[model samples]
Target chain A: MHASDDGPHGHHHEHDHSELSDTALRVRALESVLVEKGYVEPDALDAIIETYETRIGPRNGARVVAKAWADPAFRDGLRRDATAAIASLGFGGRQGEHMVAVENTPEEHNLVVCTLCSCYPWPVLGLPPVWYKSAAYRSRAVIDPRGVLADFGVTLPEGTRLRVWDSTAEIRYLVLPMRPAGTEGWSEEALADLVTRDSMIGTGLARAPGGVAA
Target chain B: MKPLNAMTAALEPVAPLPRCAEEPVFREPWEASAFAMTVALHQRGLFTWSEWAECLGEAIRAAQAEGDPDLGDTYYRHWLLALETMVARKGVAGAALLAQRQAAWDRAAHATPHGQPILLENDPLFTRGA
Candidate 1:
């Protein structure tokens, strides 16, 4: 969760444009090479960006978070059988046949780390951040969840249970962040305001009043 | 080297095309919820490995009759959809809870000048009607 823990690779943005690695240089070079070869087209780049921003992202999660905040019975259903529960709300697809939601409580914390790869609930959370699927976070979280959380400014007290979910094969985990107080009469729009990408991934909790900065 | 994948490489021919399937459009929320629900159940040990397998197989068969089989990729896609579905079904946070968290993420993302931009990578088949 901590960017610093990403490695001592220096700030990614600090690298000089031309001093980039061979892979980076080659990628840039290929653009011109393709154009010279009559392979590059104008709309291709735009299409890539459009797909990621609109077709896949947190809008999916926004809907889920909204639903969770509105219907207590539905929330219970999700906690019980997420697949059936989700189907009840008229949502389903290829990777969504099996759904599960884990609760994060005051005495217990849930952090999801895919030890194998970035096997995230993308349909729900959208594409995982590049860092989450990186080996650095994967290797470190399971061995040192507290240390990792500390980097994210989330140091839990002693005796608190920290459950590290290693997405081994068939299972993946999503954190059901605790609902912050002071919003008893909030609407779904208001509730959706509190759901953060990080909270969904279990790195941080949603703040009620002095909410964390985006 | 072999010409780069049209999608990943620069020289290949990569353009979108429609599917031949005949079902309604596939919404990811349901899939995400299903993925989450499966993961949650497995995590809680509510069902055994065999039982879960059977449930998935049944779901797959039903989906297949509708149109696509969604083999191979469903293993992980189901998990993503399941999570979304679960969130929708459970109402885990209630209205205020959802809003509060959404703002928190937004704030955290914006707090840092170098935050990673959110991106969406839609499944090709999902773009097609069921």
Candidate 2:
């Protein structure tokens, strides 16, 4: 939040730096102090970062999507009860406790937003992207979802119904993007690799089969 | 279930965090870190949850007065402010240190190009000059 020219003290002079109150700097400072004071462990921070960056993010959701695509039973399970189906795969907690899985079909498109806050299914997805919480994304997604999708380089068929999910804390939403074509016989892992985080958020479509990985 | 928190009523936010909510959704890594620190401090008995709620409520109210729309987008930011409040009050760190660190980061961020991490030349603790 600290732009060079604007701050509480309004010290925006060039080539001068003695103090700053930007969020980044404040967080770093807080972290160092917490660590030095023995309130937090540096190694704990490392592990948390590693988990979010790799082990526990969109990949978890992708696996769920790919499994649903590969197994009719799993798909049915997810449709019947998203919370249970998602939990079966070990991605259940906190922001993800309540999930409603909306699928994209030939006749309909889906998008997710929390105009009130950045409510999302965190277990299946990792941390939300910076843009997701921006006022622009939060506001426009509810008003002009198709336009928002277009900004993400996604364009839908004219007649496809665009369904926007306004996620609340109790009931978060996740888009189950349609499995792309040309992947008939592809393993779940291969299909999972194609599920981009944006697709799950309903901002963009999943990568087409044999297409680029997000 | 824990009793519903009264702070939610005081804040009167359009989209309030669910009472007794275990965790709020995080949209960025820094957001999560900011969140983790607060929880850690509270868990260690640095402050009570009610106190946290009061501090956070006040921060949000202050931001609203400063022309924040009170949209949920600024929720974590309020959380950050509350954290600053607690850390300063509890003597975990001084406000000056935070300000100094923020300045250093601002300079580093300004010098660095987009999409690159901002690196502070000296750790804020060691930099007595600032």
Candidate 3:
């Protein structure tokens, strides 16, 4: 995906140094300095990484979407105030302090992008995917949402209006994808299984029933 | 899932959006380290997210000015740069100290043998209590 894959940092250089990339080495150095200087605790850093790496991610968002699909009151709450609705589910902190949920219906679809930088909802969706942070997607999504969706193999009907949400550091967005057909009476757990990360990002649709083992 | 359509392939020649991966938020260990360090520092009240975002935005903008391409690979590099700037600006650490540490790491990395973890003590100039 790199125009010039000179190295990991995209700068050409010869280094007899050990296996770490330049940026990696720099981060390690800074981390050691911070830890030594008592600016940050090593264990705290580990805990933060562990949280994002494992504890938090799209599954949290899936549960939110599944609940919205199953519970009308919760959906109403999400519509009125997404931040409180999401936090009510015990998902709020860091990058997701402010939350907004835009629903997808037969007439309209919602997509999220950060034109300035990768301002994603960490509490819900965890860190953004590489594609979501790319300048190509950032610029293109706003200019041509349908084309970008097509790149992800998502095609809406001819008259379906597409709305793109440009996320910022202040507010992060989560697309409440339309519930798939044949999901009637399904448990929230099963419904959540159909909510993929891409679906929440509005690049793809939630999986149809039977797409995953219930 | 369907394959990438022809339209995006034709339009984006220089930098096309990468296909999304299902799992693993970070592509590298250092990325996770840098990301976690920022959050950890914020949790410690080093700086607010607004301050952090401003620094990151400036870093990204500066990188763009210097032709970063913004293809997503060097994103955490910018993140690390912003973290460094924020730490330095917040008086947590100065640029000189950070530079000193970086040089020490360079020496340590070069001195250490292959397949060995690079440690600050590995620096050839290392002196205890100095």
Top lDDT hit: 3
Tens-digit lDDT track of model 1 for B7-84: 223311321111122222223333333333344344455455444444444444444456643433343343332332
On a 0 to 100 scale, what is the lDDT of residue A19 in model 3?
Answer: 52
Can you write out model 1's per-residue Cα lDDT over A1-214, one digit (the tens) per residue?
2234234775444321112222222222323222334434434544433444467555566567667768788788878887676666555543455667787778998898766545666566665664564444666677777756655556566877989886533565667777878778788787877887777777777656467522
Winner by DockQ between candidate 2 and candidate 1 = 2
Q: Order of all candidates by TM-score, from best down to worst?
A: 3, 2, 1
**Predicted complexes: DockQ each:** 0.02, 0.13, 0.50
lDDT of 3 by residue, B1-130 (tens): 4434656556566457776456477878999999988988888888887778778878988998999988777788889899889888888878888777778877887877666777779889987644
Show model 3 residue runs off by greater than 4 Å. A1-20, A212-214, B1-8, B12-15
Model 2 residue runs over 4 Å out of place are A1-46, A212-214, B1-32, B38-79, B82-130
- Candidate 1 root-mean-square deviation in Å: 21.9
Which of 1 and 3 is ahead in DockQ?
3
Question: Can you give the lDDT of residue A27 in candidate 3?
Answer: 88
Please report how far candidate 3 places residue A173 from its true position, in Å. Answer: 1.0
Could you tell me the lDDT of residue A122 within candidate 1? 53
Q: Which number leads on DockQ?
A: 3
